[model samples]
Target: MSMDELKRRLGQVSDLNAAAGLLSWDQETQMPPEGARVRGLQMATLEGLTHELFTAPRTAELLDAAGTPAGETDAAVVRVARRDFEKATRLPTEFVEEAARARNEAHHAWLDARERSHFATFAPHLGKMIDLARRRADLLGYEDHPYNALLDEYEPGMRSGQVRAVFADLRDRTLPLLRRVTAAGNAADYGVLTRPFSPEAQKAFAWRVAGEAFGLGPAFSRQDESAHPFQTNFSREDVRITTRVEAYWPACLFGTWHETGHAMYERGVAPRWERTPVSAGASLGVHESQSRLFENLLARSRPFWERYLPALAKVAPEVTAGLDADTIYRAVNRVQPSLIRVEADEVTYNFHVMLRFELELALLEGTLRVAELPEAWNAKMHDYLGLTPPDDARGVLQDIHWSAGLIGYFPTYTLGNLLSVQLLEAARRDPEIAAGIERAEYAPLLAWLAEQVHSHGRSLTPAELTERATGRALSADPYVAYLHAKYEDIYGLKAEG
Candidate 1:
């Protein structure tokens, strides 16, 4: 029961977990329809084995004996390992296997349901997923709201009430801003984006931007296509991301940058902590901050398009024929209500996240039933965005999170959006970082994040990391201000008080 033995045991568990992640990455990206059954069993077995190994009695004994470590890195390793071990030990192996199997099956069911535009086809599977989530929260033990337990899994120490408060403030400010933009009536020419750009050209352009513009290392990182854009890593040296290209101009470009943001953080983690528990991003919220920062603040910036539009024009000359950087920036930033969350413009995207958070909370609390979700979702969309999806594919079934049992995770998208601006503000205060960004040299900015955010990994909580890096706790003010200034300039609307 020594520290060395504990590290060895945990490394094996990490390997198994990584193997399972690889299986999932393939399931979404490359697996055939017939492979679903065997993939489900394979994933379930791997998850069960990893859970058992981590929650074993000897692992507990070693954790107790290790107690604490003198070095900062060792202490972080022990702390994160202890937290994960305690959580894992609370769930039975049977529950672990069942959840894995259900998630796998539900994912396939969702795909089929989405294809057919049928909510009923996915309703039963969704009901089982909801039940599984509630059971998990119960097993984890919550003080006030069961949803808090699930929320804590992704964002440690964040509560449902905290998310509600933040969302409420954001919603109030956003509604008026959205209304103003709508009244302006397409001041920016977005017609250029809708022009036919072949998928082949789109993929090549997206890859170039991801590599050259985003600085995702070609030697260690790669981008592929998937049903949904996501990033996964076996190690920092072997990071992989997938982005979909489906005629929408910004989907492939910004999607690639978003996932690259995730991968770049992984690639930038301290090499010393590789294969250890603390080697990933500090938390899901922090992780999303990187993606949102890159996707919106950088990729969508006028300056970025100024530099990259020529390269893009070479690939999609028809689309970029009359488009300049200013036009492209305003077009991409155009505030239009949309059915798809991923395609929603920055100003309206969090409304999409907020809607999902509310629905998921109600579902977990048993106030909402699975059969009623599609209707509920449509109502909320209309309430928030003044648009209703014509089918389940564009409505309730668009996202893959629920099928994968990722309840209580949507709020982090907004949290990340808020934190992205705060983090950027802090980084910009550093003259060196500011100049680097102005000059389109991202190394300084990336290096600063590595030192301040990425390198620490799970060694610090999100609040602590924010406070240490940004000199304040998380806030919605920066994000709101960013939206107002950027949108007002684009749409030529008067600023709100």
Candidate 2:
């Protein structure tokens, strides 16, 4: 088959996958509870069709014929398409449909269980999801660990052992810092942030931050509400993000910024790669870097609030009564151990990720059972953060990842946190990017990212992209150093050796 024909075929499959994504997005954002059953079937049918189309014998023939790199873009397309084809062919279409249905059912069960703070309601569904995950790992095949097979699904080249090593380094560097910060007590007046902020005012402020502050172009992107804050885009021209707004101030504000980072990355991908296998993020880890960068490094910075807090006060004057940029900055960065991962302080966030990664490894390895997940979760929370969740909702059911069949995905979050600082440090070395950040004019910084990171899409692996952009391979040093500097100054603690 010719390259043109191959592109057309692959584009069709991509379209079907995007359609499935739209359905899933709607189910989460707009669909009523009664629609869950039909929505599950709809999603399953779309996924099964996409799987069959991509894994057909014809795709293999075309992938083989589309040999050697014609150019950089074609090379990426062929390379990514070949990898995807091999992976997809390993699983049967029935398994694809079954997994989709299972995920949908499990998501609903998790929602109900979490609402009631009942683990028993969700346990059976979790067990089913775990079984499916194991089956997927077996199908994908792995050398050293079954979790490695699942990890490669999200991170491409990453393995379980590498994630373990990185987490070990992070734990070593962070625990003492956490202890110091905790002993010092609340460094900032976080009570100012807990004041009742109306949802309407919060929505307006979040939109302003996402649209004006973050440069999520209004023409192509939009914001909505969901049970869990998320970003989804069918194409570069139509990106959508959602954030859950509550009485809390930080929920909507930072959540919108986080999703904006994800959407902006989607929007920044080169238009030429649209509708192709390589058009999306290079990997989930790289994608998470954008979100964590915007949410923590940028949104929580003193400079960010200096520019935006005045505008925010205009929107929600009640909450900003005694609050200033400095107070808000310190409040947002306050080092308090929290039950919810999404609301965790920057200093303690990775401990949450680390806990989840370990539990996921155990679950995949059959060392941990779904029935015992609540007890295990509470134990880890106490061990890592020194607090126990009062209920299962705050504990095992806090996140939607396990319910959605997103196994082996937690590590990418910490990986993203690490990469976020590395990328920011590298960008600071460039005078133009530094000036843009200093002036709160983010275009230069965004452009640098577009050119250096986003445009390449899957043209390079995550490690290769890190090296290309940062002048070194991935490491925990940049992230650790960043945390130590930021937290020590905030808490007035002595510098680390």
Candidate 3:
């Protein structure tokens, strides 16, 4: 097939993928419980069709012909599309459809189980998903570990061992910092954060702040509430985000900012690249970086509160009436071991990911059983944080990732923590930009991000993108240093305790 033919085919595949996404979104946000079976079939059919289209004999022949030296007309286009084709061609259509159906069903089961606080309800479904996932890894084939096949789905050319190497370094450096902060104790009273704040007001506040404060333009975006806070995009012009609100907690606020960070990255992609291979963030890790960067580095900062707390006070005057900026900032950043992974403090948040990474690795490798997950999760939580959940809702069923067949996705959250700090180090060099945050003007920082990172779309690899934007390789130093500096100042503890 010719280069032009390949491009047209690629556009057709993109349309199918977009349709599948919109259907899944509806299932999650608006579909009735009775619609689950139809939604599953719809999702499976779409995925199978997508897999068939990309893996057809003609598509493979075209990709190979165009990618070869004699037939290569445009090296970049051939390179990107061929890479995708090769990866897609390796998996079976049956596996793809099965995985999609299992994922959609598991997600819905997870919602029900979480609401009922019954891990038993979701256990068998998760077991089937994990089994399907392992089959997927085997079909994809790996030289070292099956988990590598899963990891490549999110971060190409990356292996499980490589992820473990980075995670080990992070754990070593982060644990002591956690100990010191624990010893120093939480320096602020976060009890006020749980006081009554209306859900309607919270939604309104989150939406306004997403645009006005976080640089997420309302022109291309809309915010809605869901069982989980997430951002999904059809294109730069149509990005959608969702968050859940709690009348007695601060989770929705930060979760909104986190999803908005994701929305920003999606919305910031170059318009010229829409519906192509180069249309989004470089990888899941890089995507997570944008979300973490906004959620922690900018939105949770003392300067941010100084500018926005009064506005919050106006909305929930009873909750924030006499609360000053320092008090609120400290409250938002309070470090404590928590049952919910999504609501954890910055210091302990990655620990949650670390546990999931280890557990998923075991589950995929066949060393862990589905029926034993509840016990294993309890033990890990006890070992890691010295606290245990009374039920599965706050334990094994806490995250939406695994039920979505996202086995290797947990590590990216921690990787995002590392990426965000390095990126923030780069962004904070401008004095004017730092002052802009204090004044609640985020355009300078947002523009810097757009210029430095977001404009590239998915044209670069994660390593190349990080190096170009931050002038450093992906590493543990920036994150460790950032945590040391910030927590030491806030909690008055030495790095070594």
Reference-based TM-score of each model: 0.98, 0.99, 0.96
- Candidate 1 per-residue lDDT, tens place, 1-497, comes to 49889889878987998999999988988888899999999999999999998999999999889889887888889999999988988999999999999999999999899889998999999999999999999999998999999999999999999999999999998888998889988866778777899988887887887777667877997778887789999988889999888777788878888898899889888987887788898889999999998998988887888888888888888988877888888888878999999888998999999999999989988899989999999999999999989989999999989989999999988899999999999999999989877766677888888899998878899999999999999989999999999999889988877
TM-score, candidate 1, is 0.98
Clashes of 3: 0
Q: Sort every candidate by lDDT, greatest first.
A: 2, 1, 3
Model 3: per-residue Cα lDDT over 1-497, one tens digit each: 37678778777888899899888778768888899988899999999998898788888777766754443224545667777777787788987888888898898899999999999999989999888878878877887888888888788777888888887887788888888888987788778888888898888887788878876777788887788888888878888898998754578888999999999998888776677777778889899999998999888898889888878988889789668999888888999999998899888998898889889988987788988898998999888888998988889998888789888888888888889988888887899887786787888988888888887776788888899988988888988888889889899775554
lDDT of 2 by residue, 113-215 (tens): 9999999999999999999999999999998988988999999899988888898988988999999999998877878777878887887788887777678
Which 10-residue span in candidate 2 carries the lowest summed lDDT? 435-444
Scored against the true structure, residue 250 in model 3 reaches a CA lDDT of 73
**True-structure lDDT of candidate 2:** 0.90
lDDT of model 1 at residue 434? 93
Q: Which is superior by TM-score, 2 or 3? A: 2
Off by over 4 Å in 3: 68-75, 494-497
The C-alpha stretches of model 2 lying farther than 4 A from their native spots are none
